[model samples]
Every structure is written in structure tokens, then in C-alpha cells.
Target: MTKDIHLYTASTMNGWKPVIFLEEAGVEYDLTHIDFAKKQHKHPEYLQLNPNGRIPTIVDRSNNDFVVFESGAILWYLAEKYQKFLPQKPDERSVTLQWLMFQMGGIGPMMGQAMYFQRIAAKQGEENLFATDRYVQESRRLMEVLNARLAKSRFLACGEYTIADMATYPWARAFYWAKVQVEDLQHLNRWFDEIDARKATQRALTIPKPFWAFFGKGNVEVQERENADRFKSDVISRSNI
Candidate 1:
């Protein structure tokens, strides 16, 4: 029999979302690593899989070899397919999708641009201060919006854990690298801690097959500290992008 799902991914914010969904929804799947440094995603074969040429593409082998790309789209797809994390009621579903869109359109893009400008561009001595400052602030602002929404409820949408949470969680925590002060955002911090403590989430965020920012499977604290240091320095000298 064919596999249930085949996920082509690297380890990162967007890439990790579908993995979490598959695990939380209890879907069987196999993961194939895409080498970012090798430009593996842009290869012709991978291009056939995802025309946009990105990670987190999935072929639903169990579903007639259907393919899906774009992290947000994948999250929505998994939620619908499993009818697990997404709300079923119409109003609730709309709200859930709204927050998912918040991440897809706002948080993810801003954070990515901010990191690239702050970490990669700055180190190259060709930093676009204007772009960096704008995106960092925008990313921080988006986080604060999330913090405010979370303040009103335990989760982002439907007042419960849903794909909205899955979509946003990975990118939100990277505010550390964005130079955003999240500690003051009490509700956001609380939600983050709660999700971080989930058994499934813990499993997701590991050295191997888990969620975003897997602390790896070693001295977790030491690894986190090292990452902290790198993020604080804007990753100026890092070879890996």
C-alpha cells in the first residue's frame, strides 16, 4: 500500500507546521529532508511537486497522490481532511481561518523579511536599515496583535486550539530574533508556554521529527543558549541561512 502522506520539508517555522498537524491529527506520514544549502527545492523534480518551489509540500499518497504547498494552505488542508483541529461550525471556522490568514499574510512574511534583513543583510554590510526597521517593527506589531487576541482567550481562534494556533506558533516565538520584547505580552507568553508544554508539541519540537525550532535531541538548554547568542548577534557570521 502507498504511504498516507509524503512531506518534503526542512526544519524551520513554516516547514514544521504540517508536521505538527500530521502528528496531532494522528496521520501516518514520511518526511523527506530538503537541503536548503544545496538549492534542492529549486531542482526540476521538486519543481514538479511544488511549482512555487518551496518546502512543506505534501503528496497525499493515500488520496490519489494529491499535492499541496504553501504552509498555510497545507495547514488548512490537513485540518479539513482530518476534521480535527479546525472548528466545524461556520462562524467558528471563519474566525479560525481569519487568524490563520493573519499568520499566512502577516506574521510569516514580516518575520521572514525581518530575519533576512537583520541577520543576513546586516552581516553582509549591505543592510537595508529602512527595510529591516520597518519589518522588525511590523513583525513586532503583529505579535502584539496576537498577544492582545490571546489575552482575550486561551487560543487564537475559536477559543480553543486549532489550525490557527498551529499556523502561528512557530513564527511567533521567533520574535526573540526579531528583537521583539514578548515577555511583557503576558497573554502571548502564557499561550506560548501552554502550547510548548503539550506532549504532542514537545514531540514536534525535537532534534528530529517535530515542530519548529527543534532544540535538537541533546543538551536542550545549551542549544537554546547558543541559538539565543546567534539570534542576538543577528547571525552575522553564520554560513547556514
Candidate 2:
């Protein structure tokens, strides 16, 4: 019997994390590009799979038909199902889950805010400076915490290359691209360099598009402006703000 997994994701930081995990775990899966540019995520079909209407949802066609959304949940599901990128011992598994949750709850959201305020909010002008600084500082603090943890262990948890690393690396990559310096966080820089050299990660980063298309875009000012206006009209129009 053959296993089938269908992945629907864009090429954002969160979207790439599961791709990296799948590649690293040597899982054969079908990739479907959800056209985020065309607002395809909000369509009824995609929303059925992910009520949040987000990218990086997966359908496990191998088993009795299971659907998983949220990048962290997808990673955990794959790791547990494959029984490859996870630990066996109870304590080790606990540690791995801890770091995985840390990435999901701490680093990912903070850095997302940082990216939002730095790149997206820049279009709205410097009036959003406080928001930018707040997130940037929080992101840097989380990076430092990871740096301290990595200084003591080879990987994020259990001293092995586990899902914790996979969960955290994409956000670290985004942080690097955002030019939020982590030179002082030597341990993190080292791990970042290691992840940068992985074949799985390299493939994940460039998946769904060519290298040029992924990075060779101009400033997103126009797109951000349009999205902001649309969001305000669609979301805020129904509420008192």
C-alpha cells in the first residue's frame, strides 16, 4: 500500500516549515500551490480545510483521511506519523514538544509581528514606529533566548536534529532576511548556518518557485497598501473601532 499526502501552502515562512520537515523525513507528498496573491486562501474550498483560511494545510490521504492545519500542528502530525523526526524516550519527547511549542507560541508570532511592522507597516508611514520597535525587540529577545538554549545543547531539544529545529528554522531565516542582526547570538548563528546548508532546507526555501521569484521582488509597498485598505474595509467595517 502506498501513502498519499496532499499539501496546500504558499511560500511564506510558516508555509515552508512543513515542506522542510517533509523533505527531511523523506516523505512523498503532492504539493499544491494556494495562490495567496489572488486571495485564494479565503475561498470556500480552502477554508473548508483550514477555517483560519491560512496556508500550509495538509491532508493525510494515507490514513483514514485526516486533515491538519497550522504549521506547528502539521509538523507534529508528520513527525508522529512517520515516527522519524521525533524522540522515543518519554523525557526526550517531552523536551522536543517543549521546544516545538516554544517556536509556535513564542518565536513565530513575535517575528511575524516584527516583519509586519517593519516591512508592511512601513508603507503606512513611520507612525507605526512604536509597533515596529516593540515587535523587533520582542523578536530579538526570543532569538537571544534560543541562542542561550542552543549554547547548551546541540539542537533546540534532546541534543538531536528533531522537529524543534524544523519548527524554528524558517522563522530564523525570516529574521535574518529582515536584517535583524543576531551576531551576538553566536550559538543561534551557528545553528542558523547549519540549517542553511541542509539540502532539505535549501529545497524547502526554493520550492513552489524559482530562487529569483522568491527573493527578487521590489518593495511591497503597493501590495501592502492595497491589503491594508481591503482589510480595514472588510474586517473593520462590521465593527466599532
Candidate 3:
């Protein structure tokens, strides 16, 4: 089948997974920038494809025009379709899946809640102290779990670069903005630096062009404040919940 993948994504951690794997696998894909400022993802047309109305949905034109939502699923879909990143051996693949699940179930949700409370919840009040502290602590704990794993293995699973790494790298790489103590986790820093230097990873970081300048690791500080400002002013401030 001719590779016809259209990636609908915004500039977020989960949004990077599919494009990262695609770039790493050398697969061709089209990027459809989802402008959250316009609520593009929640449009009736987009909802027909992904009711979840989330960023990072994929439309696979080669596969009967199938649409895949949820970034984790998109990562698995592309990995299996291209036979890249994900391991071939059962044991290694299992380990990789375990780490992927760790990100989806543990880090993503905890960090998301922490971010919402710390950033968006300002609309509700000054700061959601309880929710922010609770989720941030949980996020830190998850980072510690990952740091411990990296202390032993160079990568998260099977000692090789796999979807597990692709799945978690963006989130882990955001340790500073996530309010994580970077010095407390030297092992993860080493691992993140290695991945950050890869050429493929470099390409993956820039999904929609003309906007890549704001997405680099070094530019994270400015981007973080900008993202929070955009979210708060554009959406959260206008929303009661």
C-alpha cells in the first residue's frame, strides 16, 4: 500500500509520538496543523473521524481511509505498519508495551492534570493548590520511576530505541516545565540528551513547518509561558469549567 498518512496534530507532547516514529522510520506523511485557537479539532467534520476531539489524530488514506485517534494508538499503528521502532521479538515488544502503557496511564494523565491546575485553573481562582500539588507530586513520582529505569537501561525498554522511548521522550524531556527536579534525576537527563541529538528526532520535533522555531527544547521556556497564556486567554478564561 502506498503510504498516505495525514497527521492532524498540535504542538503538544502526545502530538509528537506518531510524527517522531514516522520520521525515525523514514515514512512519508502529511501534516495538518490543528489550530486549537480556532477549536479546529472539535469541528463537526473532525468529530466524525475522532469523537474524542483531541489533537494528534491520523487519517490513513492507504488503509481504506481509516482514522486513528489517541496518540498512543497512532504510535502503535504507524510502528506496526512500518515495522519500525517497535521491537520484533515478543519479549522485547512486551517490555516496550509495558513502558508505553506506563506513559499513557501514569505520566500523561498526571502531568495533564498538573498542567491544567497550574495553568488553566487560574481562571477559576488564583491556583488550585490541592489539585496542582497532588498531580504534580504524582507526576514527579512517575518521573522518578522512569529515572530509576534509565539508571539501569540506556533506553526505557529492551535497551534499544523503541516506541517506548518515542512514547515517553517528549513528556520526559519536558521535565523542567513539568516542574520536575532535573538534577535529582541525572540518569534520565543523559538518556533525554542522547535522544535529543538524533537527526530523526530533530526532524520529528518539527511537525508543521514555519512554526518549528517555538518547539525546540531550548525555546521551551518561552513556549511554556506562551502556551499557558494562549490556553488561559483563548479558552480557559472563557470557559466556566
- Clashes per model (N, Cα, C within 3 A): 4, 0, 0
TM-scores of all models?
0.86, 0.86, 0.89
What CA root-mean-square deviation does each model show from the true structure? 4.7, 3.4, 2.8
Residue 102 of model 1: what lDDT? 90
The runs of at least 3 residues in candidate 1 whose Cα sits more than 4 Å from the true structure, single-residue gaps closed, are 207-241
Report the lDDT tens digits of candidate 2 across residue range 83-130: 977899999998998999999999888888776555544543433677
TM-score of 2: 0.86
Q: How accurate is candidate 2 locally (lDDT)?
A: 0.78
Candidate 1 residue-wise lDDT, 130-152, digit = tens: 98889988988998899889878
Model 3, position 74: C-alpha lDDT score: 89
Better of 1 and 3 by TM-score: 3
Top candidate on TM-score is 3
lDDT of 3 by residue, 1-241 (tens): 4559988987778888888888888888788888887889889999988899997899999899999999888888888988888889999898999999999999888887776766555543557678778988898888889889999999999778998999898877765555656676888889978997998977777766423323244665566566666666545444655
What candidate 3 gets wrong by more than 4 Å, as runs, is 1-3, 123-125, 209-225, 233-241
The worst-scoring run of ten residues by lDDT in candidate 1 lies at 207-216
Global CA lDDT computed for model 3: 0.80
Clashing pairs in 1: 204-210, 204-211, 205-211, 207-216
